[model samples]
Target chain A: MNAKLLEIEGLSAGYGAVPVLRGIALHVAAGEIVTLVGSNGAGKTTLLRAISRTLASRGRIRFDGRDLGALSPEAVFALGLVQVPEGRQLFARMSVEENLQMGAYLRRDAAGIARSFERVYRLFPVLFERRRQKAGSLSGGEQQMCAMGRALMAAPRLLVVDEMSLGLAPVVVDQLLGVLAEIRGEGVTILLVEQDVFAAFSVADRGYVLETGRIVREGKVSELAADPEVRRAYLGVAEAG
Target chain B: MLFAQILVNGVLLGGLYGLMALGMALVWGVLNIVNLAHGALIMLGGYAVYFLFTGAGIDPFAALPMAMTGMFCFGYLLQRLLLNLIVRSALLNTLLISFGLDVVLTYVAQWAFTADFRAINPSYAGANITLAGITVPLARLAAFAVALLLAGLLWLLLNRTRLGRAIRATAQNLVAARLYGVEPRQLYAVTFGIGAALAGAAGGLYGVVAQITPYVGTSLTAKSFVIAIIGGLDNPLSVVLGGLVIGIAESAASLYLGPTYADVISFGLLVLILVARPARSLRMA
Candidate 1:
């Protein structure tokens, strides 16, 4: 088996006084698509934030054999872990092209960035058409595409996407999932946090069921889909067995 | 013809005023730092140019870049080492700290440069040209041109460059910026440095036109605040236009009312605008 690209153990995190994540542990192997699914306010976003080092947390996060302790968010990003945060937080006033360029802010190689720009434009052709338009003007689906494109511009090893389907139409969600698979085929690891259990299970190889900040179940997506508790509580589907 | 000349004078002075507010606007827009000490930084820039001219015989125009570079370094270090520490604190706290910084910087300038007024008087300082029956001071015209050039350069930097994109991105969303591998601390310092550099340039030109004393920062700071609000935070050109509006207002006020009412009119307009359309400036502070 390939080595674990990201390993989190005994992680705990929270906003100032409101503890959100407690004793959580998870891992994703190289080139794997891992999904973390839970209801709203279940600490899914907080876990990703902790892994990205954007929030203060107590944990041992070993990424690519390096300890991610005491690293700033930028340092964590330099290690090739990037997050497409919730709300498609594109610089609203900036043009789509400029927003994509911002994704490569730390990079100095001109040719490499140009290639990334081409790749992103090809992946989302609408973005190419609206390259000069302000990002805020883009539709919800377009903004989502721009956000994903922006994340790709960073050439991330692990793309952490939070709330992939939030505020997106079903068709757009399916389109994004297809793109995620294509991205995974390019050898980038994906750690996705979603409230849409069924949607996440469709693309994810492995899954974790988080309940109020704690991982209650961890298994292959097939097994998770079969789990009666998960089906009843999250999938809202009746059990066959 | 008299009105046209007054308009030109007001516009020229307004150019310098716009340059003064540019830094404040950038810092406020990007780093969310309302640098109360901005005026003091301008004073320091004036002193820097004054010394370079008096002691080293460098031309005042040539000394402008030197002052900008010096102030940039000073502002950069001040942000990296000091301001960043309290940046995550409450807005009121940041405001208080900046005010404290203003006090300290003002006192230091007073100690080093003395309380006497100084001006940058080159050999051609009194040179003038008459264009279409309007008398224009050569230095003021040059300063006005420089202000426009600087504002244009700033617009290009923000729109056409990667670093500028990073700075703007950082301003819009810190978390998103980090994902792009931007270290906020360094970026914040750079933004503040650029703001200070603009202030320095403004001060350098200001010394050519007006008297420079250690105490000039307070009123200048107030003027900058008004201009920044009038201009809005995003566009550099708008900020310059905002400065022009104030310049014309001041020129007209001083001419029609009295010299003493120049400030009163400016402040009064600010209050009127804010009270009338609170939506404009409310988002900023």
Candidate 2:
């Protein structure tokens, strides 16, 4: 209903020579939290990589009305788009505070950086407490929080998060999902690739079910949640459509 | 007493050597370029200051910044026009391209400078100050101090400044770097230029205490690699300590064995250290 913030038409992509995503189409509305739900090897991560231009892709991806096919990964990032990649790829050698500072690398306004630093610290107070310690030393849950915080430091208009709940305890996942909801509330759009079905579906407004690089199901959260086939195959529920 | 004197001398020399490696380390750490030609740039810096002092009648120390500025431009253009092409391609490509540049520069230096071993002989060159029976040559001490000062400045830049933070981010991931809204290509060139400027400063100081020739690059490069690796590309302080280790090792070898054996000793240590900590050394680097 909102003007489309991102639109993909017949987008095809792959790593190396093998094609993973075959002419997939998807969309995300402005200021909306869209969850791309899929199982392992379902091209969820690959699609994000394609959107971020980290992997080579074909077809048209228009983000905020700009052609994304021609942009380099760095160029895509410069357009206020940031991704919290799989496995929380924080710079392990850097301190927690330094890692967050790195996210603001493209920014020049010192006052804004200081403000964002405080905001991230407020979101994850544990990070503020351990800001001086090396990022590698943090617990897994903390690292995920830090990864999201690092992405936030970039002041992204659209945050593409891949597997934020992966390897995280349920409690930690709930906390991160809650914070993400708050970040989205503050006008940061999110494209979440979630493996945890319940956690993702609970917060998402729109949902797309990716199966082997194609969108097999697309609808409002309530529609997809009640779709018997989606529940049976993806949601692990004993229901038939 | 003799061992103490040797150790002190080694540390002084090591400080300068560490300074020499600092540029290579920075470039390698941030830019991810091995920059086999780094020592050649250092040699050029020495020659620049040498010519400025002799031809233009400028004081060598005062002309140090001038030489560094020139070298920075040279490095910036080199990266923009040449190194940038293959920087995103592969490690082997960068290594090969930089080595080619090194050879080209070395040959050009030989043709232009005529293989002369030039040293900057300022009025304070021979002066020495002694404290508690330890004599420190004025030129060497001044060079050592300059080296430490530069290292401190580099540390502050990486840890305290915004440009330094961006450079570190580029070092980690270019995608993340771009998201922060910085142009990576220009950032890379700037980072390379800074590395070259550091090398130029080291070279100017180096000419004060040592001899320079077109051939000086090879040894300095080997030494720089050793220090950069042993220091582990993460911290500037590690590089200084790395330089100190090599300096002490070289001095001990020269004093205990023959002077020629010092090369063997340092290289031997370099090989042993690299071989021993293979994974840990590279991961941080």
Candidate 3:
């Protein structure tokens, strides 16, 4: 197994007096795609928020051997753990190209940013074509592509994407999943939170089942897929094949 | 011809009014701070230019940038040390705190400068130009030009520059801004500083055309808020246009409905606009 790139131990986080994630422990190995799957309000988004430090959390989160507790959100992102937040929060009024530039905000390397722009444009040809159009005007699938492309411009070593499939057509979701595979092929690690358990498990190397803010089960994708209880409860498959 | 002359005057004055509201709108749009003390900052800027002209013998126009720089530093510290502490508090808290700052600054100005109305009387103050029988005062024309120039510069900054992009991004979503390596605390201070600098420029121009006192800020602040809301925070140029609307409205009111009714017209328009576009105006605020 590759060395752990992100390690969270006994992570607990909540919003203003109510605990959302309780004693959650998770890890992502370098150069691997991991999926965190759960139902609605299962603390999936909350966990990601904790990792990104967007919300206050209590626990030890060590990323690339640095104590995350001591770092601000910007510092944490500077370390290359970038998140594509839920709902594809692109700067709506900004053009697609401008949105991508925003992802490269901290980078002073003009050449490198230009290169990333090429890479992103090549990956999402539609975005390149509509580069000058406002992000809000784009179709849902295009917005998701822009969102992922924006995250890529950050040059993330470990990319955390929440609900890449949300509000997207199944075909679009599949296409994005394919892109995710390609992104992983480029040696960038992925931590995906998806409501579509089947789709998530199909693409991920390993999976963690979150139930009510705690990890109920976690194992290699094959192991979790074959687990009868997981199938019955989560996959909606009454009986294992 | 008289109506046309009044219209031209209003247009020129509107340009300055737009400049005044630009800073308020930028800060309000980005920081979500009402900045009730904005007019006070403008008053200080007027005094800065007045003193530079009287004591240091500097040209009022040249002193504009100097006052802006000083006000920028002052705003930076004010936001970083004071407002940043309570930025995450309730909206009413921010409004109350800013109002308190306005009172403190106004009293301080009164004590130091005394309750005196001073105008910046440069050699060009009385100069005027007549084109097609519509007379234009050179000072007000210069003020109008400066206002448009500043607005143009602001538009360029927000749309063309990297720092401007970060500021706009921060305005939209702080979390996303951080992902782009923007530190919210520092960025907020920088934003407020820019806003204050713009206000300082407006003050310098305001002093050139009108009289300034410690109490002038209260009304200017109210006028700025009205312009900001009517203009919409989406674009800087639109805010200036909003100012023009008010300027013309005031000029027409004073000319036709008596000078005493100008204030009533501006405030009345403000209330009517707010009452009419309840949702759109409320959202901007």
lDDT of each: 0.90, 0.87, 0.91
- Clashing residue pairs in candidate 2 (N, C-alpha, C atoms within 3 angstroms): A106-B180
Strongest candidate by DockQ: 1
Write down the TM-score for model 1: 0.94
Task: Report the number of the highest-lDDT candidate.
Answer: 3
In Å, candidate 3's interface RMSD is 1.2
lDDT of 3 by residue, A6-96 (tens): 9999899888988889998889999999999999999998898788887888889999888898777778899999999889888888889
Model-by-model DockQ, in order = 0.75, 0.54, 0.72
- Candidate order by TM-score, decreasing, is 3, 1, 2
- Candidate 3, TM-score of its B chain: 0.97
Q: Is candidate 1 or candidate 3 better by lDDT?
A: 3
Candidate 3: give the TM-score of chain A: 0.96
Worst 10-residue stretch by lDDT in candidate 2 chain A? A232-241
Best by TM-score: 3
True contacts kept of each: 0.86, 0.63, 0.69
Q: Which ten residues in a row have the lowest lDDT in candidate 3 chain A?
A: A232-241
Ranking by DockQ: 1, 3, 2
Chain A TM-scores of all predicted models: 0.96, 0.96, 0.96
